[model samples]
Structures are given as structure tokens and as C-alpha cells.
Target: MIHRLFRHIDAGTTSYTDETGANPVSSYTCADRLDRERRTLFRDTPLLVGFSGRVAKAGDYVVEEIDGRSILITRDREGAVHAFHNVCSHRAAPVAQGSGNARRFVCPYHAWTYGLDGTLQSIPDGRSFDGVCKSAHGLSEIPSAEKHGLIFIRPGGGDPIDVDRHLAGLERDMAAYGFDRFHHYRSLTIERQMNWKLCPETFMEGYHLQYLHRESVGPIFFSNLMAFDSFGPHTRLTLPRRRIMELRDRPEEDWRLIPETAIIYNFFPNVTMVVQAGHVEMWRSYPSGDATDRCKVQVSVFTPEAVETEKARKYYEKNIDLAIRTVDGEDFPLSEAIQSGHAARAHETLIYGRNEPALTHFHASLNGALGA
Candidate 1:
């Protein structure tokens, strides 16, 4: 992948697709389309929910809401990962709130308790309800699996999650990163006034880097250049920094990609894994409350090692600040304008140029999943 990026830099060319692609404006404006997308792309698919480090110990768990589906993920005492609906088995209220280490989850609504494995452990006044069977009232289990140091959960239950099968051949490239060893640094949730699809699209193409992000991150990278490849519906994009040109004077065997490029892995519909110079940023976007024009994105930053000192925390926090300034401050505001434009019906469709192969592949994959 580094070699491919070097070649693209030398030739002043980028990866390209066979042709251009078009996505209807309605894809981001219609409620009907959003509903279908939530079902097919989110519910059925095993999404990258969190990393292994976030739940490294027994009883560690995380709660995340994806497309309005409250999900609870936990690690049992026996070192097993489990996922279930956050809802209580009693009156359908959430059993847990945020991430923590807990042997049991007690519902805030009625104090119905559940074990880490999602079994109904105990209920307050168990004899009060007649004809109620505790054995059949365990928390609703959802398909979940952890692989390659990444945790995944399928919001709508069906078959068990197969991480290797879902990743296809991409894991061969990801194995070197040792994602399982990464330490969680920070996490945040931000709601943006744009379609959920627009959040990931900003990272897919470099066409606007030199222009939109000119003052912030543009000068550090070449404009409109990317090394792109697709594995099934997922994609790996390599964006070389301007410092990458320094590799020409170094030996081929010493050409390291970690410090000279930004690698972005798109996990199909809603998740993006961005590997930066020293840290990794994971983004998961979802439609906000059934509105096509509104979206919420969950962002988490992971470090190669645990941040044990104040200096280390500050260093990683600086990276997060730059990301917020570039994406949240610049790209997102423009995306909001784009969403407003789509709502106004200014154009019937949006065009993806041949040079933007990743964008084309993503939207095409989304359409295929929606059966459109």
C-alpha cells in the first residue's frame, strides 16, 4: 500500500474507477429512504462498535445508541464478549446507560437485574407477577463478535457475526497495526446538520482538502490524490502527506507508512477507521431520530499505548483538537450547506467524478444494499 501511494505521488495521478457515478438527491432527503437504510445497512450489518481496549477486562462494557437502537456490549467473567438490547426484560426500559465494569445491570426503571451474560439474574419482588417465567425473560441477545482487536455488533439479530468473513481480505493489511493493543484515549458524540452519509464522504475523497481545509490541513497533503481499493463493500484509502516525498531519498525497505500517510478504512455503511501518524480515529455515523437531514456521529481516538501521564494525555488531546478544527469546523459546516441544498431540491442528483472512486464505490454499495 505504501508503494502504491509512492507511485501515485511520483506520477501525480490517483486511483480511478471505470466511470463516474450519480446518487439521487432524494437518497439524503427522503424519510422513506432513511428507514430502508436503517433496516438493511445498520440493523442487519455487523458494525464496528468499539475496540478491544475499551472493554479489555472482565465485566467491562459499553453502551452505544446506533440509529436509535440502544445496544449494550459486555465482557463476561469468563472472558467472553456479549451484546444485547439495553432494554430490560421487564417493562422494556434500558438496563444500562454508559460504559463501565459491572457484574450485573440493574434497570433504572424497575430495578430488574441482569447478569453480564444477559441472563435475568434477579427481580425485585419476583413473586408479584403471576405466570411470569424468569427463565424466558433474559435480556434480548443480539449478534456480536470481537476480532482483530475490534468489537462488532449487529443491531437487529439474525445470524452470528462473522468478522473474518465480513472483512474479506482486508484483515491481511490490518494485522500489522495490532489494533487489539491500542489503548482508548478519548471519545465524543456530536450531532451535525447533514445527512449521515455525508460524514464519511468527507474522509473518502481528497478533492476538497486543498480548497476547503486550505488553512488548516490542506498544506500538509497533496490535493485530489488518493490510493484506493475496495474489499467487498469496504474500502481502504491511503492519502499521502506532503512529507511522503521525503521517502525518495530513503531506502525502499525503510519506507515506513505510519508517519507519512493517513490510512482510512471504511467499514461499509456507517463506520470509518482512520489511521493517522500516531493515533487512530474511529467514526460511526447514524441518522438522528429518523430525520434524513440530521445525523449524529460517535468519535473515538485510540493510541498505540496507554496514556499514563499528563504529558501523554496532552499530546493525544492535541491531535483530537486538530481533527475537530479540520472536520467539525470546516468540512461539516459545508456539509450542512450541502444538506440544505439537497432539501431545497437545487439538483436532482449528486455526481461523483471518476477520480473519486471511493465515493462512487460507497454510494454504489449503499444502493445495492438498499436494493435500489
Candidate 2:
């Protein structure tokens, strides 16, 4: 990471683009396009649903709503993670409600019971069914896996996903951070008035940091000086902190990645994995109820080790608070204004500057995924 930083510095420039510009307004803003995206892109592709630490033990489970699909994720006694459609085979009512440790999930509507592994265990009445196969009527399993401490699930119309391949070999690189060993500390979910893409897009670049975050995070980090590395549809954006210049006096061998540079990994579709000084922050955005104009952002923080003291806890608390204020207080309000502009058709087409190559690659890749 430091090598790349110095490379950009030596070249007297950060990453760049040719004169071939891109239209920012060229997005899936219409209802039809959003429907198609939900059906084809999100449904058929693998999605990072939760951090593995969320269900760190046997009998632990969590119910997540992803793109209109209610999903039940569980870790069984044997320590295997399973994902299933939360719907009961009996009356289609959800077998699981929220999150907790459960030997088995029982449908709240009736008495239909399901094992943690998603098998139908019992039905209150056996005679009520006519030619029903209990084994065949278990909860429908979604293509999912717990890889590198992250749970991935495909909701509908998709083939099984090879998580390693899907990550474009990032699993090996991410091992250095020990994401699987990290403990989830906190999470916050909020509804936004902008499109889901806007949330991740806002994080893909630091070009706006000097301006948008000038008072908050801007002074601490460089603006528009970023290095982009693509791993298939996923990308890693390395933005150095102002303190990174301190490494100049030290030997190149003493250079370290963490604490020096803030690495932002864009896990394609929605997840933004931010490597902070000592912990990790994951921000996930989901399209709301098939609407293109609205989305939900579920942000979480994970630590390599638990914050054992009030001072440590307060430090993390302040960091997260700063992030919340910067994004929700500053960035999101701008997103709302941009959404209003788009709604009013303010510009025939918005343009991405040559400096914003990450946005260019993202939208282009999105268009490819949508088969535009």
C-alpha cells in the first residue's frame, strides 16, 4: 500500500482517466430499471449479508430482510452456517422472527417447527396434510456460505456462488486483517432518500473530502490523492492520512498498511468495507421495497479485540459518531438535494470528472452487470 502511495507521489499524480468522460446521470433511476436490477443483478449475484461474528456460536441465528426476501441465517451445533428462506413450509409464515439462540425455529403463525439446519422438524397436525412430503417441504435453502468471517447469500434466480471466485482472490489479501476473528461491536440502520448506489458511490472516492468533509475528516486525510485497484467487480481504494508522510523518514521495510492508510474495499453491489486504524467498518446498502429513489444503509463496526476500557470504548464511540455526523449530517443531505435534482431533470446528463475514476469504473461495471 505504501509502495503504491509513493508511486503516485513520484508520478506527481494520483490515478487518472483519459478524455473519455462518463455521464453521472446514466444510472438505473427508473422503476423498470430498478425492478430489473432487483430481479437480475441483486438476485442472481452473491451478496454479503452479515459479519460472521454476528452468529459466533452454535444455535445462534439472525433474520435479515434482503430485497423483499426474509432470510434466516443460523449456526448449527456442528458449527456450520446455514441460510434459508425464513418462510415456513406450512402456511408461508416466517419461521424465525428476529435474532437469538434457538435449537430450532418454530413458525409464529402455527406450530410448524424447523431445525437450525433448515429441515422441517415437526408439524402440529400430520393428518391435516394430503399427500404432503415432510422432507420435501422443509425451508427452501438459499445459496449461501460463511467465508472469511462474512456471510453471503443469493436471494433468488441464482446459481450457487463460489465465494472465493466471487471475491476475485481478495480472500487471501484480506486474511492479513483477520476479519473472521473480529468481533462485531455496534450497528446502525437508517433509511435514506437517495438511491442505494449513491451511498456506496459517496464512499468510493476521497475527491470530495477536502470540500465536503473539510471540517470533519478532510484535515486528517488527503483529497483526490487515491490509488484504485480492481478485483473483478470489487475495488480497493487506498487513501492516505496526513500522517502517512511520517513514513518517509523510516525504511521502506518498516512500512505498514494499517493505521497508515485507510483502505476502503468496495464489495460489489452494496458492501463498503473500510479498514480503519485498528478496527473495521462495514457499510451495507439495500434497495428499499423495490424502489429506486430510496434505500437503507446498515453500518456496523468490528474490532480485532474488544474495547476493554471506557477510554477505548469512548474512542471508538467518537470515531463512529464522527462518521455518522459526516455521512448523515453532511453527505446524505447533499444526496437528497441531488436526488431532487434528478427528479426535476435538472441536467440532461451529469458528468464524472477525469479525477473521479473510481466512480467511472463503478458505473461502467454496474451497467455491465445490468446488461445495459
Candidate 3:
């Protein structure tokens, strides 16, 4: 079934096409293109990176990986959000390991210190260079912006694009998910042996829900699925039936009250979000490099009541754990096997069934962007 609902593009048209007939694989999936997209999307433009749920306050911080670059996102004393290259300027050490609260980041290597605002506070050798320019050598500041409870960052020291412009239709639908009202309950990371594209592509449609996820998640969703709408490179797919709670013998009344059982938001290039009834989870996949075709998938879970109560917190945590086991334990291993099979000298072009419209759309977008 076709669920086509087009939203008018209000912003001035931005061209996204390749001149050459030769379609270049996504710069996101391509190793050589990492520097380009990183510069353009993360460094030059304010791309959404985090949510303003639990960590929206001053001194709250999280470590994120965007386009293969590790980033440390922090809110300053004044509650202003900022981002920096998570790598220490001194000795190239990783400034922060995982997510936590920090007033200052001290590099585990050589003990170089930096303020929460990305200012280089002190170096071990204060006397070594008497007049060394410290102001010019602070931690590289990545442009960042906060909107609708989401934190965005531009990684490549470039100019930033308007966040609202990028989030046009997404904002409306996401608001319906109560994204702004939700709090961050849990976050998890999964290392997959497959290409980054494989991860998002896996959730692009519900065609595989009945076949691949039958035991774990299949029995809960509808057989006939619909995907509607595309803005720029982003797309959203809506699942009609209440498959998730079906296993629990949930009543139709409960289903009717729920906004959507499944809503998958594909943010062009690498990120994808799965909006469920109770929580919203986002996955950012980064290709390890160009040649290997291996990628890392980072999953962040957000709920509307993480900081509210202990029971709410546990509920979110349990939900996150179930999701991780299903995706990482089941989906990822299969994807990895597929990638390896595709890479074999004996294989040719991979095939996509007609029912897999999401995957088809993804490939079409990839081809268009890369000039394939």
C-alpha cells in the first residue's frame, strides 16, 4: 500500500545531485568521503547530535561519535550547549571515554586540561613555553545548536546551516511522539561487522518484519506496511498495525490511544530514529573506513520520564536492553554475514525485493547523491 503524504519544501531548494553518470557510493559509506561529509554536515553545518532530555542542564555532558569523529557535548555554566572534537589537542588522546557529568575534561594522556566550554584551561608544561600562544591553541570548537530539546553539532570548523530548515516535517511528527517532553532513560552501543548502511537499511521497511524477525518481533507487527513521505534525503515510514504490544494481548483501545506503533525516521547519510509508543531511540552509524566496509552503530535511548522516578528509569532500561538484544544479537550478526557474502569474489550485485521499498528508496537516494 502506498502511503504518500508530501510536505511542501519551504526553504530555498538545495541541490543534492551528482554531475557525473558514475554514481559515487555515499560519502558516508565511503572512507575517502568521510572528510567531505564531516566537514560539510558535522563541522560546517549544525547537525542534530543529542536530545535535551535529562542532560539539558548545565554540567551535563555526553560523548558522541559523528562521521567517525568522537565528540564531547557539554552544557556550560550558563546552560549553553557546546561541542568539541573529543580528541585532546595535546598528544591526540581521546578527551572523554564515555558519557558522564564533567565540569572539566582532563586528558588521561599527559593530563592536559580543558574547560567544559572547549577552552584549553591548562597544560602540564606552563613554564616550558613562556610566551606560547594558548588562546589560539584551545580545543577545536565545533559549532552547536539546541532546538526542540535536541542538540546539534557541526564537526568540521565550517559554517552552520539552519537547524529548523533541516528538520522541517520531522519536527511536526516528532513532536507528536512527545520527543520534547521525553527524557533520556538509557543509551547503548553495538559494534556491528556490517557496513553502516546495512544497519539503517535493515529498519527502512517492515517487509522483513514477518520473515526475519518473526520469532522475536515479527508476531507483533502487521504484515501489510506503508511508508510515506520524503523530504530532501530524509524519509519516514509508518507501520499501520500495533505489532509491538500485540504479543501481550493488548486491547484495540490501547492501540488506538497509542500514537504510532512504529515510526522510522531516516535522516539522510547516516542517522535513523525509531519512535515507539513509550520511547524514542536513535541510531548513528559510522563507517570504520572506506575499504573495509565495516561500521559501528551507536544507539541512544530517550524516554519522557527518565529523571522522574526509579520505576520509569528501570522501564526504560529494560526496553533498551530488549532492543539491543534483538538488533545487535540478531539483526547485526545477519547483516555482517550478508556484507561478508557480498564482499566475496564469487558474488555480484545484491538484490532487493519489490516489497522492500525502504531499502529500494535508500539505494535510489544513494545512487542519486553519489551519481552512481
Candidate 1: count of backbone clashes, pairs at least 3 residues apart or interchain: 0
Q: Rank order by TM-score, top first?
A: 1, 2, 3
Please provide, for model 1 over 283-333, each residue's C-alpha lDDT reduced to its tens digit, 9 standing for 90 to 100.
889999888899999999989999999998888888879987788899889
Q: Where does candidate 3 stray beyond 4 Å?
A: 1-47, 123-125, 175-178, 242-260, 307-310, 345-347
Write down the lDDT of every candidate, Cα atoms only.
Answer: 0.88, 0.83, 0.67
lDDT of 1: 0.88
Per-residue lDDT tens digits for candidate 2, residues 222-301, read 78888888888888889988788899999988888778788988888888988888678888888898677898888888
Q: Give residue 21's lDDT in candidate 3 (0 to 100).
A: 25
Please count the clashing residue pairs in each candidate, in the order shown: 0, 0, 16
Question: What's the lDDT for candidate 3?
Answer: 0.67
Cα deviation of 58, candidate 3, in Å: 0.5
Each prediction's TM-score versus the true structure: 0.97, 0.95, 0.80
Task: List, residue by residue over 263-334, the lDDT tens digit for candidate 3.
Answer: 788877677888777778888777664444677777788876655778876777676777777788778888
How close is each model in CA RMSD to the real structure?
A: 1.3, 1.8, 6.8
- Residue 201 shift from truth in candidate 2, angstroms: 0.3
